[model samples]
Target chain A: MTFDWGFVGEAMPDLLTGLRYTVQATVLGYAVALVVGLLVAIVRRGAPPLVAGTVHWVMEFIRCTPLLVQLFFVFYVLPGVGIELSPLTAGVIGLGLHYAAYTAEVYRSGMEGVPRGQWEATRALSLPAHRVWLAVILPQAIRRVIPALGNYLIAMFKDTPLLFAITVPELLFEANQLGGQYFKYLETMTVVGLLFVVVSVPSAIAIRLLERRYAAV
Target chain B: MNFFVDALPLYLNGARYTLLITVGGCALAFAIAMAVGILGSTRSAALRALASVYVEVFRGVAALVLMFWLFYAMPLLTGYRLEPVFAAILALGLNIGAYGAENVRGAIKAVPRSQYEATVALNLSWTQRMRLVVLPQAWAQMLPTFGNLVIELMKGSAVVSLIAVSDITFVAQQLRTFTGETVLAFAAALVTYFVIAQVFVALMRLAERSANRRLGRIPARPRRRAKPAGAAAKGGAA
Candidate 1:
């Protein structure tokens, strides 16, 4: 019925454990998303029509579906086909894959924003294809896309709670369990929300600064 | 396999709830977004800050957390419980309103500054200028982003499953639990989501076409008349 700081203080240790999981899942998941997204973006470029269309459709489909259902599917369904993964592993993969679809679009747009002349100039110099991509194209595209990708990471942070459905002991899950045991949803959930904003807000500001600095060039 | 057949009716029923949440939440969000967008773009610093904080909070927080807060905390605080569907709609509308406000703000700003001055010179008040000059142009700029947000909303509605809303995802989960046909149920949900998202995008394209038709004529007709008259005057004077 009211705020209970004492219960919150008592639960701080367990909450910290959940917080560690939240941070790990978000960081690891984002790392995976970054790599997978790069691959998707690259595959789309210079691919045949069917390959391109299939990639596009698959990415869009992944982007549109809820990560919660995806998490459920990965955790529960894959075992029937003989792929075994822990709940945390499944949750990370789900989050990473879901956001990878979005990040690929960001990468594609960033790559497109690179002037066509840049590619032509590279070819005219007789530079190796790999060299062109690594030296010129990727640096520019990745720099341009850092802010959007950072925002997605922040989103991934907030989304870590969905892992709770599969029994991953993240912040919200910990808070809910604490609440159910002690009947103090107000303090626990409020702290969880504040903690989320605490991490996300600064990261967002950093992303904005990065966007401004790069965009000016 | 039998699970798929037996749970067909429930999934179909669940699909209706899913549709309702998506459509209902999106429609409500669109209205809220427009209002918030208008308010945010008003030349008042205080109002702008208020809207900014609101958008940041909703957009920054996960939709599931917002839903949990609304469905769980709202009832506790208010002593009046909203039904799961209403809570889902409310949480979703508010969340999308936050992001949609940004799109609206960007779209409104993308309209040339001269347009606002034209409205001002015509002695239109602030509200009238916004309604007549700003909104129509903003709507055009807003369509594609709005389409994307609609898809986001449809996917977001899946979070309602957490609060025990009997949407397709929830039904699928139930079927999976009951029948162990986890893959089939999930694949069906995924495909259903994909089809529904694509349909929303397609409808947005149709809306964009009609909107372009309306806006496309506004500029061309005036240009046509002005150019011919100028040529006629130049010829006669020579």
Candidate 2:
């Protein structure tokens, strides 16, 4: 029960390997979310009423449910339908898709924040729709939402521990494994918790800075 | 469909625990939020520093990690084991309270300076000013964010299954193993959780409407345009 520096030193290599996967999952998962969310937001805005309404409800369904259940559904149900995925892939998809629901809302608000005059000017200049979206609207909209997106990025990073449920050897998974192997849950879990704090606190401060800078602009 | 029908009672039983944890966690979290939030916004430097440390440490860690630490590790240090439900509530309350504290602080600080000066000029004590004036307004501002936090806590409670809490997620997993109905089991779980979240959302909206009405920001009756015109006429008469 007493704190053990020697045990921590022994656990560091496996923990570091787990940290690598954690970062990888967060980056890859967030990449999927950002792109998929933008598509969802755009479609909800421009699609026919039936399609848009369906997309909206689907997003709500995903948003309202717990992410852990979604992970279970993807991992367990997909194989029955002849689409097997590795634990890592399943975890990434679940995290990405669940968070995309949230990010889509952020994207919608960011788009709404774009001034009406800007849209009117785009139409006045006779710009094509794609150009208007890519060259003008998205650039401004995305810029304003970067801080909000960054907050989600940090949230996803903290949530990487949930990947353990699907047997991904992420940080918490490694710590739990070590705890079982050595019967030292106290030290192993404490170290893992500290690792999370170390990574997240600095990122949170940076995001606060980003928020202030964007607000000034 | 038969599998789902058979599993409904089990899932509902699990959902009872889920609701218990959510409500218990939210109560504890709200208490923590009020304490830390008020301390954080106070003029005392030491109190602010203490509140910030609590906020950052709890907010930065994953709720799962905290749950594991409490359920598995803390017993080693403290020589006392926690019940699974109590540990889940404690871990979640601590974790979500960190986020809710920021909401409380922000809402309190957003109260106008003139209002604070008016309370002081009226010779009200600190508690009286906060209870009567500042908090009534701040409570309304905090409700929306607290609603979101309650949902977050409810979702986060699913992680309690890892600690063998037999919540909805745990029961769903059991149903899956029993029936070999992966999609049905989890789909039922998802729908159940979604329904609970929608209920929380509805409750929060009612709270917000009532809070606004208490402040006279909304008319007592539903005639919006007429009430505004009537308010204008009363202003002109005055």
Candidate 3:
């Protein structure tokens, strides 16, 4: 059968709405991941041994399991317990929490990358722990960690499709729905795939630039 | 809840299937990675470009999309039906191959320039130089990254559940459906994955130690700068 670009063009608006949701979920998910990951990193760093180990184990547990299963768990189990959320909320939280485990590792590396002398200097200056962490440690650590964090962002972006399992109206799920409705898997999925490349390519180039800049410094 | 406690054998069977998918997927991913990595490193510009595009497209797209495509869209596109297990393996193998290609390429590039020069000085052919000199070091360096990839592949294989593969995740859903013991099933899935990931970590550390011992005796020589004239010639030829 001959290819049909016309069918793809007609379906573009629906896919674009899906794309908008994809971008929103990715951005919101990354924001949550950054915040949660930082907290996890801090807890892992200086909490009492019991607390520290628990955090470590939980992060490991989160990292090992598949996000798809986690999505299902939150969607099904949360409602049973009366903590209902929209599928989009559940999907974002799932993606956020999963990537947070990974970002915590990145944050740990960034903290380790900060020189011991920097800590000593903070101690010598008698800065409060919270202030030192916010004013001194995080600034440097987060700077060095941009590329790693960018990788997580890209990963979270790719993983947004797991939302489909929970019936979130994201790009992939929308494409699948469109495909089913029209029996046009070729156009819908093909466009979705190309859109992924178009967005991800610039993000990847930006990450490389960030890496080079840090390397030079 | 009572049923979950009693139906342990069925859950265990699901876990077994999860392990099967992981092992099978990892093996296939490793093979595809090696081929793609080597081919991507070719001097032929067209070959390199093709490999580059394949790696980027696969790696950049979501694995779930790939799985869905293979499971549902492939049949639609090609009129060829595939069993869920086969589709899972194909999607995972292709996805992991893309990421693994980057690791392998980076690992090869990480070999010092002077080593390549020394191989030339000994009058070794390109094949001999790669086999005897470059790849051994690259293999060692690639071990940790490859281990991480395997862990990722294991995690990714759970997506096969969407296609009704009777893997652990699917089994968890089945248990939840039959017994309404949501937490128990979810907890089992979590613990199973944790144990599997821990095993991979332990194995990787062991491999790292052994590789370190094998290559330990010789200290790495300092990297030599390539002569500007030779670099110019190679660049021009390429």
Give the alpha-carbon lDDT of every model: 0.79, 0.86, 0.78
User: Sorted on TM-score, highest at the top, how do the candidates line up?
Assistant: 2, 1, 3
DockQ of 2: 0.43
Q: What is candidate 3's lDDT per residue for B65-182, written digit by digit as tens?
A: 8777777666767888888887788788887877777778778888899998999999999889889988898888877777777778788888888878888888888888987888
What ordering of candidates by DockQ runs from best to worst?
2, 3, 1
Docking class of 2: acceptable
What is the CAPRI rating of model 1's predicted complex? acceptable
TM values, all candidates: 0.92, 0.95, 0.92
What C-alpha RMSD separates each model from the true structure?
9.0, 6.8, 6.8
lDDT of 3: 0.78
In candidate 3 chain B, what residue range of length 10 has the lowest lDDT sum?
B229-238
Best by TM-score: 2
- Name the Cα RMSD for model 2: 6.8
The TM-score of candidate 1 is: 0.92
Computed on C-alphas against the true complex, the DockQ of each candidate is 0.31, 0.43, 0.37
Q: Which stretches of candidate 1 lie over 4 Å from their true place?
A: B1-5, B217-238
lDDT of 1 by residue, B125-160 (tens): 988987888898778778867877787788888988
- Residue A110 CA displacement from its true place in model 1, Å: 1.6
Stretches > 4 Å off in candidate 2: B219-238
